[model samples]
Target: MSTPSADESVELEWDDIQSGALHERPSPYVGRYVLIRIDDREAGRELVRRLLPAIEAGHPTADPARDAWITVAFTYQGLRALGVPSDSLDSFAPEFRAGMAARAAELGDVGDSDPGNWEQPLGTPAVHIALAALSPDSVRLAKVMERAQQAYGQLPGVEVIWRQDCYQLETGRTSFGFRDGIGQPAVEGTGRNTNPHEAPIKAGEFLLGYPDETGALPPMPSPDVLGRNGTYLVFRKLHTRVAAYRQYLYDQASSRAEERLLAAKTVGRWPSGAPLSLSSDQDDPELGADPDRNNRFSYHDDLDGFKCPAGAHARRANPRGALDHENSVNVRLHRMIRRSTSYGPSLPEGVREDDGADRGIVFVCVGAHLKRQFEFVKTQWLNDGIFIGAPQEADPLVGRSDTPGVFTIPRRPVRRRLRNLPPFVVTRGGEYFFVPGLRALRWLSELDS
Candidate 1:
């Protein structure tokens, strides 16, 4: 595909969209997430371009750039969808593949590498295909997804299923029972695609720009090197030790969940976006209404950790207090649009003692810089204990390690040696991928065709 032309004049505005502010707008109601799995890298990308027309055609608005938001999660398997089970899935694979191949032949490939008719990017690779994210406003987006199944439902070697999403956060980090999106930089825009405020808009600002106060960005392609609108996505299926976590909580206090849950509320955003801080003592329905009130609160309260906590997920994700003179830097540089969902099964009633129902979260992050936001949370706050003041290693909930997993609690010990601390979360699988803008998508499809 031809190199994408840069648009240097798209200025982004930084607006305060905390949980309280979001509630005034309207709950971001959404239904059925559509995912498509493809093989290998090249074929997966080609298929994505080929399917763009059909996918975009399904939307009510004809303009894909403004109306559609597409993010690709690259793992061992390029694209895979969860929670979309239709009976016609068996027949849709081959037809879609043929369409992708035909489109590639129509437009010659363009880039540093020469190409002709190429094999599907997968020889023995597995991938996931995520469609344009459908917000509450884009009601027709779901219908388009439904129609996609009609065209290729019976294709073999592909599985489509339905998923129950638990939470969605700013900076694109889902509620994984661990702190995410902490210390993320804010760009000047809306949705989960653009950068937050407090950061520069240089061509490589988010991607491969010069290193600032922090260490160098991860070894990934910068927007300058690749294109302005491209960003990387990381996906992982984390298994939360619900039973063990609960046991540790109960052992510590009379009502552990109730106490911690309240702390979450004070922060104005629940592990999910329920916003107990703004709504009722329980999960408030209206907190999702006003964005002004929902996301407007600081843990600096002396409320005995009732409204907020010393190390709650929301607090840990964005420790605004740590910034210049009371987290002024955090307010500017640590804002990210987190978009994540829960995976695995719900905890069964009365079935305590670690059943391993395989519950955790699907962590998906989008920002001008992937390493700055997602990677930072993973390596620093989540994995490194230094951010929390404790002399420990890794996040008690979702930190990474070479020796399986670990967890930590205030009082008492459950798994591991409570003293050395153990990981409360475990990682099953994860991979890094890129999400491209609509213009690039069209260019790719037309070029290879």
Candidate 2:
């Protein structure tokens, strides 16, 4: 595999890029996600024209420290509903044109992932647009929502069909009790470097008009300004069965310590967010808290999967030089930036029983090439076991299986296998959207019908 020459000199124009859900690192304490549909093409365009200024850019200081920030995106149908020209519409990735629901089977969403089970507006063609607002607190978030409502109120054709509010839990844990959002890839030119050893990927890998891992520009939508700096987004509403997850851990392990270790091994990270490759023997809260040390470790040292199981969830999602091929350069090509947030009520801490509450993450994956980065990871890496040398095993945390799933724990003398693993997470809904740059938003607003 050929490694792209490291271009550390590349610098991004934050002002030109939209408030990238991929690399902005908003870390908003509160957020509101609104799904919209366009009833009239003309009115929708006018609405976008009127609201363009309010849409935040990717600039570091775009959002006031105390106030809220807003970002907007549209689905393929949403762009059509707004009367985007046929030529421009045809330029989108085929997967975006196909929509997320049509590819559910390949994504391992056949049973519970079926579009029939998704929320009303999600899987259906009704969803045209998504508006997201992020703020430091609930009050600020409410004000942002109010502004959005006021802006939309003038456009009768734009209708909000669904809204989801999310916040950071006190313990900083997902519903499954694991540290969330710890492992994020550092994009080139973003100025947000997390791990020193991890090479900075090409900007085109996550943004349009820049060189990608292939050293070639990805296929961008027509009208250069409209496509530049824009990226594709995969939005998913995943519901975690916290009670079942907790119970499964209890049943699988012989003791409390073993249970914790089992959970860490399954996820490839301790509850504190320290990677098993770094803190294999115990959970290191200090190391987990230190971003420099936590995300710095790689699988190169533990190739055999003894310290961190080869089939672990994080490992499966991002092998990070752990693959038998030992090709870190190739692995970088498939990397994606995650901008997920927790939704619904947080299950009471230390409570092992099911509270029967709806809670999980609003998973948002942002990338330039949907097929190579997002779809490939979802279909080949996360859901399938062949890539990592585990043919029958799926991801222990999120992989779906009807009969049973297997998780292999590589240990000395004998390898331990967890069998009959049931699905702990379910997809409530999802959609594909195009997050355009600020100029692209303006260009869209001014498109000739």
Candidate 3:
């Protein structure tokens, strides 16, 4: 396979694609995710028809209308529930058809994170549709949410099962106290190249109907209108133990400075979002605030893991320039568009006792290939660490460490290893959905009824 070429130019049909594909979410925004089930085929189809007019094409971040809009996707069972033909449904990727719940073992969602323990309607086949609405302010969000509710409010056989309202806190940190939504990839066609070190990835890596990093078009699901401009989405609700995380860090460190450093090494970034690769010794709030410089550093130079440990969460998630030495490792192929938000309330600072309030993050990822992009990262990088030369260790933050695991941090004269690492993030519930294009929405609504 060839690397993404900067010389390549392809104009995409922005009007047909979902707006989230090109959406650059604003900081301090509020959003809601709703899960629905379909009992009657006509009702499901009618729900799509009503939502079609509301979900328009991609819009710029500056566009006021961009703040308030809804986007929808369907599960494998959802397609069948909508009366889609067998051949078309079968054409979808096998992992997607099997559902995230079925592939839990492969994703290392074992022990307490198992699917059996997942939230109701999330892992079940009843979850047919997923709707997401976003806005910078609550008023705008309410306007669109009202429209979204009216879209399926009275539709018989179409029931809204579960919903999660999430947002970025005033501190701009997740429940875990790290800045979220950094290191976003720039698509080749979009004029949003933020990272100066790397060229824009191929457009097909995230959207269908274009050449991906492998120099070929990604596999699309059946009829052109249904899959051409569409892509797959992975939505997850993770339950974080904020008190446990805070106490663990406190116990591991002797002073406040050491505590901050330990947190940075664990996540590969400071609470301000400055990458350890650039600011290794101390936290740099100014660098983290600068969009152009914060995400520009790479791990290739820190091969010995002195600056940023190989097993750190950010490095393991995206090795970037570090994997060039590996023969079969193509970091670009495993990339996914990540846009996650925090749910529940942010645990107050310095509070080490369990509050019992359910709080964490709602992760949203978009890609054309489910198995390669989303699943590959979860299985290979997060769940296991063989690629980074540590087989026993998993992601220190989210990995489901059934038995106590170890996290290695390389130092000057001697390396430091944190042992008996317990799982910090638990899987509350999650699902996979096919986020279709505007034309595909029309195609789905107009299906034989």
Candidate 2, which segments miss by more than 4 Å at Cα?
1-6, 26-28, 62-67, 324-329
318-421: candidate 1 lDDT, tens digit per residue: 65544334432443233344555554455654444776465666555554454456555555565555655543544444444333333333322332223333
Q: The CA-based lDDT of model 3 is what?
A: 0.86
Of the candidates numbered 1 and 3, which has the greater TM-score value? 3
lDDT of 3 at 301: 91
Model number with the top TM-score: 3
lDDT of 2 by residue, 281-300 (tens): 99999998887778776787
Q: Report lDDT per candidate.
A: 0.39, 0.82, 0.86
> What's the best-to-worst order under TM-score?
3, 2, 1
**TM-scores for the candidates:** 0.56, 0.94, 0.97
- Clash count for candidate 1 is 94
Worst 10 residues of 3 by lDDT: 1-10
What is the lDDT for 433 in model 2? Answer: 95
Task: Please report the candidate that would top lDDT against the real structure.
Answer: 3
After TM-score superposition, the amount by which residue 137's alpha carbon in candidate 3 deviates from its true location, in angstroms, is 0.4
